[model samples]
Target: MSEMCPCGALLGESLMPREMAEEGIFSNLLEILMSASSEIEQACKDSNESVDLDTCLLLTAECFRCLRNACVECAKNQHVMRNLGLISTSVHLIKLLHGIQMKEELLLTALRCSLQFLGNIAAGNRDSQNSIWKCAFPDLFLTCLTYNDEKIVAYCCMILFTCLNSEKVRELLDPGNLTVAFHVLKVYKEQLESEWSFLIVTDHLLKCPELVKALYAKLSNQERVTLLELIMVNVNEKNPVTSEEVNVLMTHADFLAGCFQENCEAVLKLTSAADAEDEEALVTIRLLDVLCEMTSNNGQIEHLQSLPGLLETAIDTLRLTHIAGKQAVNIFTATHAMTGQEEISHPAVGFKSHLIRLIGNLCYKNKKNQDKVYELDGIPLILDNCSIDDNNPFVNQWAVYAIRNLTEHNERNQELIAQMEEKGLADNSALESMGLEIEKRDDKLILRSVRKKPS
Candidate 1:
């Protein structure tokens, strides 16, 4: 008899071009796994010795690894494994190991290897993928995703990414079950540090604009924040936004505007800056950033601006954060003047700049929004926020852009800004700090750079 390791047989078969099914290697591997499962169950029930359980787990893991290797790019072996009920066996073993409190490393390793097998076998095979999906669609996958083990969570995500066809994704997005998918996305955001497995799955789901729209409609406010963060992650990565990303932004523009409106309402309700310094405010700040990105895309700005309460939300958020930020700066300056300690700007400090950016994009070549901002007295607010702040980086630049957008082709807005500068209502300290001085020449404010003496 040939002296061959049962777990190593399929691995060798994987190295050759010949099909494992042609040589009955798949059957042999299944037999080894069955024998190992029996041993594991028997050891768990009857044996008090830890060594017996460890040995069986190691054998089971090896068998899983062998099968995982065999199924790699081998449709015949994958079909054979599925036909022999390996998928159920793998899920059963995972459930078995999940129940047992044996060595943690061995147990998790077996679980991870089992998921690897399922993922590879179902990689490109629709029938096999559907089979695995039927066995472990939401509950088992969600349960595995909640595991503290990142590798296990990542493998579960891989299985999801592999098996979730468009129909399945839409099914998962249904109201009753979307929570499970949403939970997986939350886990992707909060739990997993690695992005490959999670990114592919999220990217795939986000590609279906209508499906994503439905998914967005079903999320609560907090869940909406999480989903926006996920979308922003992908948006921030691509240099020039792809067409697919543009479609997503266009589809969600109105909903995103409504989300901002709700977040801004929450901000306006807070009576004090201290109350606005919590995680909810942070989420609001992030939502502002997302809106900033959305408005930057010209195609979506009209949709965003047309939504009721968007302008009110933007102005309200700016006014609230501006008051809080100024109070924070005043306090910091008074206390740190002599000590020269670096001021830590308030948590809401960045909110002003982002809100300004949103206003700028909304006003870009849009006279109606420009007239509306002037009516709301937002120009002075924008002018006042032009000074530099450590927390709101590039705020001055955003204010400048907003001013230009507010004035472009709008004589009323232009006159308002010019009047503010002429009355010295807009302080000159901001201009002097930037080594630029404004002079009224020919009834126009001309910005002139300051000259330095030669050294």
Candidate 2:
């Protein structure tokens, strides 16, 4: 009988089975697997159209499985294990196993078998880590996220995160694949009820600062503005879905702060100068809130300096009776508290100037409220605030009385005197005749007696 051809195809009336018998059949299988691996690799190199390559890889994976089992079954054939080991050493075989659909148990089996043998050959000899492993199986991983397969998606995310740690692997990653993975994260961000999405994305983001920076750069200014607006809305909504939203915002605070600093002038110009009646003012307010929260983390003072007019704008906005001054104050106070530093290092400039201006305004208002304290609901609040103002006296006196229950120490009385002197305010002789003596100290002015006037 004529020998069968090994191509597995027929020409004319001749049926070519690639090879004959069990041994020849195994040899043909090995050849096909080798060729298939080569084609798959070429496909990877040429383009991302790996569907056909994947199908071929699947066939090769099955061949590995059949051959490995055959080797075990024919253990009596002493050469079987050696043949299996030889096949495993083929780089093409390893690539084939890696390229096959990871979802297939058979493919996974083949991978285990191949790795076990290849691991031995490459043992202690550092070979490049498997490059194919870094190719994100976007369709599979994303499907896992879409189907709410949290465990699998988490596992895949971890794998991808690790793979991305390698500069070489990261460079090899297809941008489209990266985008799909990111979209999976975004979908999880929008769809998942739990915070797994946030946790996973945040963990990944923390690993890749370059990725985060690139993402920020890739987003258009409008997109970034929208993201900031979204974060602000979530943070300030009546009730947040989860504290995770706030935590995520905080995690990216530095990035958010940079963006805010870059676009602050534009933002302020748009919002501050916009018609007060326009809805954009609300957007501006939200943006400000985000900026405030971003800066609420450590190093905020340095971050704040990057924004040219942010402090002035904040101070101006807070001074407005229309804006939420209390809220603004709370934000500033939180920022200051976090940094353990003053809002302005120079109490003689910037916020201090604004604060002094505010004190003057409050003092003027307090004079108007003096006779109408009972009728003016803001009297107590004004009195409380005035006590802290270093530029007001009439207000400080009432403020001191309001807090008299808290401290009997001369500090409070002395503070009042210092404030008066700082503002060039002096006691009226009418009150002095009733006995009040104001003494000036190097750092402060002190009230010494009720009956003496400074000569």
RMSD of each: 5.7, 18.0
Candidate 1, residues 330-417, lDDT tens digits: the string is 3211122323366655655565678889888888888888888888989888777777666566788888788777776776775665
TM-scores of the candidates in the order shown: 0.79, 0.35
Instruction: Give candidate 2 regions above 4 Å deviation.
Output: 1-130, 134-155, 166-181, 191-200, 207-210, 217-255, 261-307, 316-455
Model 2 TM-score?
0.35
Highest TM-score scorer: 1
lDDT (Cα, tens digit) per residue for candidate 2, span 329-403: 421221222242334331111222233232222223232222222233222332224433322223344433432
Cα lDDT over the full model 2: 0.40
Go through the candidates in order and give each one's C-alpha lDDT: 0.70, 0.40
Output the number of the lDDT-best candidate: 1
